[model samples]
Target chain A: MGDYFVLAISSIFINNILLAQYLGNCPFLGTSKKMETAVGMGMAVIFVLVMAGIITWITNTFFLVKFDLEYLRTVVFILVIASLVQFVEMFLKKSIPALYAGLGIFLPLITTNCAVMGVCLILVNEEYNFMQALVASFCYAVGFALALILFAGVRERILLARVPTPLQDTSIALVTAGILSLTFFAFKGMV
Target chain B: MAKSLTQEFVKGLWDEVPPFRLVLGLCPTLAVTKAVENGIGMGVATTFVLVFSNILISSMRNVIPSKVRIASFIVIIATFVTIAELLMQAYTYPLFKKLGIFIPLIVVNCIILGRAEAFASKRGVFRSFLDGLGIGIGFTLSLVALAAVRELLGTGSLTFWVKPIQILGPSFKPFSFMVEAPGAFVALGLMLCIMNLAGRK
Candidate 1:
């Protein structure tokens, strides 16, 4: 139990997926401009990340490892993720129409987002068991959502504040993201 | 045709520089840049993948159906990425380990896909080759520049290879913060700001 707690806190706070691990930052900056979009992206990521994490783990253990096709991990994992994302989009649209309406557009984007792929790779590297992988994946996605939402809030406000002409859009967003990442460091030693 | 190819090549140096100007491939840009050596390793690895994938995809552009072109491009990119990974492990094991996940994650890098779809698919093989080379070098330059700033401030030294060459004397206390996770963002942010300022004038 204590070990699980540590993993949760560490993944969500200390070694956050976005701030600390530097995964999934492309969407971190792009979708973070508006709060709704950030929220949408975050939900889509958490939903997909948890499933991908579990699915990839099983694939690696039973399929890749069994065949000693470890060299093809990159190619295999990507294909798995791409197909999974496609499947999820179709299912969401068919069964969960309302929910799909919200997360539909963001779904395709998650296919390419590095956070999902990065976390899956980490899951393999860490050699975590099934339960641990599940927990870690969920927490990491939560961490991504938390950071994205927080950054979105700050960015929305920064839009109004008077700033230099040159540092208008992406330049300023990056600077703010840096400060946000700095604040996350406070979570260190908490676990 | 010759002038245009040169123009295409030179454009990636400044006009469409992968990280700075194009603003694609931020994942690797932020991660794996803690050391100058890491930056070079990453840049070279990415360049290898980019140049080859562009050439292959460009040549096979017509055969790839438009509907599945993105998928085709990804498969092609992933194949090269795997090749790059194996080559790195065979030659530069330490740097390979340093760049671990980010190396495979390169398959999803926006810059590679962006160039594949935007430039390579529509252009000639030679033109795509030039485009990839130019952009790859631009990406390496950006990585090295960012890595230098972080490593220098974070450690008071620059590491081109295994050894750290101390540029700032013994008395200097490393800013340390610049090399940490947060420091990558801050350094890149400040650098982007500086780029903007320079571009304006």
Candidate 2:
């Protein structure tokens, strides 16, 4: 139990998926301009990533390792994620309209979102068992959401400030993200 | 198609560089560029995927159903990525370890997919190949440039292969931060800002 707790805290804080591990940053910047989209993207990521982590872990343990098809893990994992995103989208649309409306636009984007793939790959690489993978995936997804929401709040404010023309959009945003990452780096000592 | 073949290739070097102009593949741009060798290795690996996937997709552009085109494209890209991963493991194990998971992450690198969807799917085979080559080089240059700044400033030395060569005076203190995670974001951000300023002229 304590190990799980530590893993959760470490994944969420010390090694944040977006700020530290540097995964899933495209969406981190792309969808983070607005608080609404950031929140939506966060929710969608948590949904998709947790599912992907579990599914990929199972697949790796049972199928890939069982048959010595481990070399195909990369191709298999990507295919699973792409198809999983599609499957989730279809399932949500059919049984849960309200939820689908909330997450619909973000689902397809998650297919290519490296955070999802990264987490799945990490789960297998770290050799985390089913239970640990669940805990870590959820925490990492939460961490990604945490960073995105905070960054979105800051970005909304930065829009009001006067900035140089060249550094206006992504330039300033990245520098801001750098500072944000520094703050996250502080968490390293705590771990 | 007013642009000449050379122009198509040249544009990616400056006009449409993947990381800077298109901002397509930011994940790898920020992650693996702690050193120059890793940067070049990654850039070459991505270039392989980009060139081949573009060739395959462009050649089969007419046959793939539009509805499932993205899936097919992904499969094609994933195959090349796997091949790249294995090749690196076999021949460049050191780089493979340095790059680690990122080598596989190339499948999601947006730049490759962006080119495929926007350029290759609609273009001739040779043109798609050129587009891929151009973008790949552009992406490579961007990584090398970013890695150069970080490695030079942070460590006061640049690495070639495995050895670090001291490039600065012995008295120089390494800025160090430029090579850290936060530094990557800051360095890339500032570089983009500088590039914009330079391009303004």
Candidate 3:
């Protein structure tokens, strides 16, 4: 449907999880040192966020909502994410060693990465149904991936730019993030 | 043993601080720190969960296998986060509603889990407690500072319990952006720069 495309575009630029919502910024500022690593991390995050959203949606709608144990949502969701990350790591390692080699380190890190969990929370809060949740997760993951890659590219450029020692690493990253966030603010008018 | 325990405890406050120094827990630090009150509330709640969970995890570290340590640590941390959520609801209903989902989202807060795996799992119970306390206080202090600057700049008047605590009163107008998202980044970035400069000195 046109609605799904709209959702994807809008979420990716306008309602961006990092620049707009300020979620999952740890990787944005921390892991964006190199473009290749950023690309790898972004793809890894995309897979994790979509899978997390889907699994959490199913778990919430069927188990938490039906059983009236909605209070356990946080506990259950975290456990699921951790296990899911583990499963993915093993699966990728066995099936596609090259892909695994690229994403392997980031996989363990993604388990605790707030972005994956944050997307699931957003889907639940937005009250997206199973199908909508899937679409939203896919869009949101892509958005996060896009933001990561963009920042990584910028940071790679930044590395060559003669910078002061004090503002070298995290400070420069934060300033860059602030600028990106301001740019993303322009998307507020789109939706 | 004792000196290292002190080192672990002190590190969280300054050297290994969650938000400002280490930049670990960015989500809550930026999101909930719109106001001084919210920041303090979130900081204390997170500290409670972090300290307690660190204690429990450190004590049980020997039993949990290396292969499944991370999963077990998360479950343990989640249990405490749940308890903290319930306590917040029971005692501070108004604050609970204000905090909303962030309370539960504490389950995934990297600071707590990072401490569990990095320090607590390898340390003894008493030292873990001390480390947790130090880190928790440090996190709380940073949140309070960020919230204070944001609240003072954004609101024109800081408030607690619906009463305005005036610093400059009606004579001063607030810069609303300080209460917004970009303001969080600007203020934190500036503060980080200042702090790093001071540390170098």
Candidate 4:
């Protein structure tokens, strides 16, 4: 129980998926311009990541390892994620139209989000059992969301600042992210 | 059409250079570029996968149904990525360990899939190959440049292969921060700003 708590905390703060691990950066920079979109994307990522983590872990443990097809994990995991995203998209579109509309294009884009795939890969590489993988994946998604929301808030503030022309859009955003990452660094060694 | 092939190839070098202009594959661009060797190793591995996958996807573009094209493209890209991972592990053991998960993460690098979806699927096999080569080289160049700055400033020296050559004076104190996560963003951000400023002229 304590191990899970530590794992969750470490994943969320110290080993943040976006800031430290550098996964899911495309959306981190892209969808983070607006707080609403950031929250929506965050929810979507959390959903997909946790689900993908569990499914991939089950398949990896039961099917791949059993069959000695471990080398095919990358291909298999990606295909699973792609299909899972598609399934989630359809299910949301039908069951929760508001969320489906809110997420919009970003939903489909989640298929390529490295964070989801990264979590699955990390679960396998770290050799986590089922429960640990579940907790870690959820926490990683939370960490990604935490960073995105905070960065979006920072970017929102930066929009008002008189920035230079060359560093206007992504350049400045990246610098802000750098600063944010540095701030996150303060949380290091806490675990 | 023949002339356009050269145009497609040339554009990725500067006009559509990745992680800077396209901003597609920032994950690996930021993650593995702390050192020059890792940057080159990653860039070359990605290039190998991109070039081959582009060709393979281009050739199969006709047979693959449009509905399932993305899945097919991913499978093809994943195969090449696996090949790159295995090859790197065999020959470049140390660099392989340095890279770790980012190598396999190349499958989701976005540049590869972006090229497949944007350029490869619509073009002929030969043209797709050129597009991949151009973008791959461009990405490699940008990554190496980023890695060079980080290594020099962060460590006060640049390492090639296993040997470390001191570039800065012995009295120089390395910034250290320039090689960490935040430094990657700041360095790439500043570089982008410079590139933008230069391109305006």
Top model number, lDDT: 2
Return the interface RMSD of model 1.
0.8
Please give the lDDT score at residue A159 for candidate 4.
Answer: 85
Model 2 TM-score relative to the real fold: 0.99
lDDT, candidate 2, residue A190?
Answer: 89
Best by TM-score: 2
**TM-score attained by model 3:** 0.94
For model 2, residues A1-191, the per-residue Cα lDDT tens digits are 98999999999999999999999999998998999999999999999999999999999999999999999998999999999999999999999999999999999999999999999999988999889999999999999999999999999999999998999999999999999999999999986
How many clashes show up per model?
Answer: 0, 0, 0, 0
DockQ result, candidate 3: 0.63
Kept native contacts, fraction for each prediction: 0.71, 0.82, 0.51, 0.84
- TM-score of only chain B in every candidate structure: 0.97, 0.98, 0.94, 0.97
Considering summed lDDT, which 10 consecutive residues are worst modelled in model 3 chain A? A163-172
**Residue A132 in candidate 1, Cα distance off native in Å:** 0.7
| Per-model C-alpha RMSD | 1.2, 0.8, 1.9, 1.3
TM-score of every candidate = 0.98, 0.99, 0.94, 0.97
Q: What is the lDDT, from 0 to 100, of the residue B109 in candidate 2?
A: 89
What is each candidate's DockQ, to 2 decimals? 0.82, 0.90, 0.63, 0.89
Q: Which residue runs does candidate 2 get wrong by more than 4 Å?
A: none
lDDT of 4 by residue, B95-192 (tens): 99999899889999999999999989998989999999999999999999999999999998887677778999989999999999999999999999
**C-alpha displacement of B185 in model 4, angstroms?**
0.7
Model 1 misses residue A169 by how many Å? Answer: 1.1
